[model samples]
Target: MLYPPHQPLQAAAIPPQRGPAGPAREDESGPWHTEAVCRRDEAGLFFAPSKEPTAARLSREEAAKRVCARCPVVIECREHALLQPEPYGVWGGLTAAERRVVLARRRRREMELKKAASAPRIAAAG
Candidate 1:
């Protein structure tokens, strides 16, 4: 379920991947990445191993999110995660499930805007 923005994130989190530091320096690839707080954190802290208990997964995700909360590049991190549609891990202080919800909302809003924009044109044409 969705929680209020001010409410501290709880439950259902994932681990982040290890990558080079400081705003993803662009190389041959055009995409740029922001510095992630999780980079300094231990990998095990973010993700649970296979067959882990539900409680353990929840705890690990919570720990990862705590780190994300303190991150300076949180917005950038979140944008990257959302764009990449990061399949796993808590990026930008949000769990994967949370991101999915966010994405769905975005899609719905976009569709509404598009439909609204076209309505006038359709009427004009008619």
Candidate 2:
């Protein structure tokens, strides 16, 4: 019996690489990087919108927080913001007040966890 001719398989097309000009880099130490990411435009200013507002008033600070909320590198931004503990402006999707609330909550949780972890040691000593 004669064997059938082997069919050639079509190769997948590879996408062309664009030279440079990619998205902005996330710099942790650069001043502009943090400020630029948090800066609010004119529209964002003079408004105080809620996080999930339905026709709520919008303020400059709120707008700044909203913008940061959707940012790609928000986690890093938040970490930097936490380290700096900035008194004003938005960082990592959180306003100055919000950041303070988060920091407080974080500290409380850390203390709780530490206490729990040390409780066993105390019990063992007794």
Q: lDDT winner among the candidates?
A: 1
RMSD of 1: 10.3
Q: Pick by TM-score: which candidate is best?
A: 1
Instruction: State the RMSD for candidate 2.
Output: 18.5
Model 2 Cα lDDT, one tens digit per residue, 1-126: 100001111211222132133333335643224333333344234234347354343355566666666666577556656766656555666767788999999999999999898875535565
Can you write out model 1's per-residue Cα lDDT over 1-126, one digit (the tens) per residue? 211122222321222233433234344642222245565567677556799898988998898889888877678678777876777777788888999999999999999999898875535564
Error (Å) of candidate 1 at residue 31 is 10
Over the full model, what C-alpha lDDT does candidate 1 score relative to the true structure?
0.64
Residue 108's lDDT in candidate 1:
100
Candidate 1's displacement at residue 35, Å, is 3.8
